[model samples]
Target chain A: MLDPQIIIAGVLNGLLAGGIYVLVAVGLTLIYGVLHIINFAHGSLLMLAMYAVFFLWRLAGLDPYVSLPLVTAGAFAVGFVLYRLVIGRFSHGKDENILLITLGVSIVADNLALLFFGGDTQTIDVPYAGDIIQVGAAFLPLPKVISCGAALLICLVLGLFMTRTDTGKAIRAVARERQGARLVGIDVEHVFAVSYGIGIACLGAAACLLMPTFYVTPQSGYAFVLVAFTIVVLGGMGSFLGAAVGGFLIGITESLGGLFLGEQLGQIGISLIFILILLLKPTGLFGSRA
Target chain B: MRHLALAAALLAAVVYPLLVPNYLATVGMLMFFTAFIGQSWNISGGFAGQTSFGHAAFFGVGAYTSTILQVTYGWNPWLAWPAAMAMGGLVGAGIAVLSFRAGLRGSYFALITLAFAEVFRIAANSASITRGGLGMLIKADQRPINFQFKDQIWIYYLAFALCLVSLLIAWWLTRSRFGARLVAIRENEDAARALGIDVFTEKVKVLALSGAMCAAGGTFYAQKYLYIDPNIAFGIDKSVEMLLVTMVGGAGTIFGPLIGSIALTTINELTRAAASVFPALKNVQPLSLIVYGAMLVLIVARLPDGFASLLGRRRHA
Candidate 1:
């Protein structure tokens, strides 16, 4: 017989994991949707943001939560520059070339982080790091709860912003049909930059919010990125609703898998699930193409 | 002209081990092996245009199979090598059959492969047969069954020979019908499919063959090192290095990966040597990665066809 509290706790954890997935997955999908290039280095950008938060905390003594805006800005600037200098040059090009370029960016960023920060995992010892909230018979860590809250807030805000803003509408236009958007006097280049910027900012925010709950390391991005990719694929690339919904599904599946199976098995199980999803639905559950 | 080029390449490879310093000899061996991996990658990724990111799965399969056989059954490492390679190829074939059957190509195919590699890595880490994370260590130091080397020179020589054989195979593959189909699929899969070419089957066949070739490389790698660990065998860095070699030198050409390997490996060795003196540079072991990334960007931006195309042009000129 399974513990009822364990199930509840798993659901909560899943919801949190799902929220983070949505944030990372959205960025990946958006870039892929607009540019038709899968940003293999998406995780590296997330890593950069985590490090940004680390430095802010260590140097400026700013709280991780308080530094969200700063990290968001930093991520945006990085994305904008990358688009203007690197991606802008390759815009409207072959997809493989773009994929390779993004992969290169990922490699550069990962190694740079490794070089400067060393291959060590660092964490912020926040005041609430040790705090936990007891839910009936189950206990939830406070940091995870906060991370989940931040993830939800970020997604909701970004979703609203994308749907509400004219810039956002242009971005959507670009994603849905590039040639059509270009003919309508929409600055496709600027739209590309803004969408890419928003996507990077989303990942950046995720990295910062996750710092309190998880340690930051140069190699950490690979793990998260893999999961995020799985979520993106499962959620259907470029589908915002799919990303949000897929995040929770994967998170819950992961939590339940982790609790029932061992930790290692849980991770493997998710990977297997990712492969299955690809096989069953190449366009994804909510993919636009299919 | 091709024969002359091949002869020249063989000459360089044969003499390389003798002329290079010990550290360089080791790097040379790695470069050769990596070149082999890259060439094999090109069969599927470049020629077939599959772009599998999970090649480490095949590599790990080869290493683990060889290691387990050598350790448990006391099989001669040489005899077990072919068997180990076959297992990896078989797995690759299985993956191809499944993935390509669904018409999953390009990024979708690459993601699936990546996931499979991660799955294999995690499973290997937890499996008792792999000794879990402890991995497999040789019981004897220098017995023929042990596959342990008393000197690095021997391993270098063996790796060099394997490299030559792999290059020859890669050359033959490019001229073969299967290779032609792979290239056709790579250039335009939909057109190939329309013309009665079984694109899915061709992709799987090439991927399987490439997996086998990579597995052969992995078998030798494990046997030479006489140690096999999940992380080392299934590392993403290995996959990246293979891609770097192909991308840097030329993807479709026969000797592209080989040239890329030599150039990149030499630069890496140079950086490593510099690191020994500077110390700070040593901490940044991944600086080469940045260079690799930059080179990738440059290649995509300037010459999408790769450096080999430049050589081809010069030849035609």
Candidate 2:
């Protein structure tokens, strides 16, 4: 018999988890939309950003919250340079080439982190790391609530920027029809670099948000990236709004699964949902058929 | 001349373990095992153009099935191998049916396979039957019936035979109508479908074959290593390694995966040797992986057609 309080707590935790998933999924979707590359290295880039925030917190005594801008900027530069130097060369290549290249990048990034960070799990001790807020029978951790709020705000800002800003519109246009956007005088290459930068910036922001709640390791990005992939697929690939909705759904599913099915089965539950969705609704709940 | 070269190569492979030390033979066996995996992956990825990132699902299923049978039921190891292959084929068919029926293609299909593999890994980690993260270990018995031998050469020969069989299958594909259809699908699925080919059936068939072959490789791995763990059998690294070897050698070609396995294994062995020589390099635990990553980037950027094409170009010249 499940307690009402447990259900409520689970739902709240799921929402928080969903918020982070949304950020990561959106970053992946954005990269896919503009570059037509799945960017397997997306998670690895987030891992690097997480390390950056960790280092900043450890060395400068800076809060992860305070280090958000710096991490995001650094991630953007890394993504931008990665595109110009390596990914750009394969822009016109086959899909497998792009996949392999990104996979390779991920391998390099992870091993480099392993070399420096020594495979130990690292976590930040934020002031609110252990604080909690109570609502009736339910309690939410302060860090989760803050991260959830920040994720929403970032999503909203990204949405507005995509819709309202000229550069954002150009990015959307390129995503919608690359040849048309090119014909209309959009600097395809510049837009690509910027889009990649923005995609990576999203991961950077997510890393900072995540550092308070989750442990960081050289391999941590991989698991999160897998979850993000599931969310993206569930939300419908390449659809921004779908990613947001899908993230919460996966988050809730995971929490409920853990409560009902045990910890390992909870992870299995997410994968099952992912496979079922791919089988039954390849277009996703909100995405139009490709 | 080509036939003579092929015969010479086969002779060399058979004589290799006899001449080399135990360590070198072990490395050669591992290289051949990788070649088997890469070749199996090539059926779906190179020929059919269904680049899966989750071949580990099949590999794990095969590995776990055989190991579980041998360890728990006291079954002969040779008997478990066929059963493992069958289980691998079933899983492969199931994935192919579900994905192809849903019209999933390209990246969507790839991710779904990965999810399935992850699901299997997690399941293995949780299920008591798999003994969870503690893993399963086969008792050391130097009996041929148990698929265990005291001499490392037996395992090497077995691995070599498996690699040869996989290569033959690949070669047969290149000469068969089914192979042509697969190539057509790879070139353009829509066009192939428009040409009256049963694209779904073809994809499913190839995937099943690929899955079974990969599972066979897994069974071989279990028999040689005498251990089966979720991480070793179902990890993303296994999947990526299959892709890396196949792509580096040339995905669709018969010799591509074999060549890639040899090259990659050599690189890995060299790096490990270097690490032992240099105290500083020893701290970098996964230096070979970094090298592999770098090689993948370079190959994709410079030799998209793989190293096999280089040989083709030379012959033409």
Which model scores highest in DockQ? Answer: 1
Q: What lDDT tens digits, residue by residue, belong to model 2 across residues A125-212?
A: 9878889999788888999999989989999999999999999999999998999999999999999999999999999999999999
The candidate maximizing lDDT is 2
Which parts of model 2 have CA positions greater than 4 angstroms off?
Answer: B283-285
Per-residue accuracy of model 1 over A28-128 as CA lDDT, tens digit each: 88888887778888998899899999989999998888998889888998998899898877644656667778877888888899988999888887898
TM-score of chain A of each: 0.95, 0.97
Docking quality of model 2: it rates as medium
User: TM per model?
Assistant: 0.96, 0.97
Q: Number of clashes in model 2?
A: 0
Q: What iRMS does model 1 reach?
A: 1.3
Q: Sort candidate 1 into its docking category.
A: medium
Among these predictions, the greatest TM-score belongs to: 2
For the predicted complex of model 1, DockQ is 0.74
Distance from true position, residue A207, model 2, in Å? 0.6
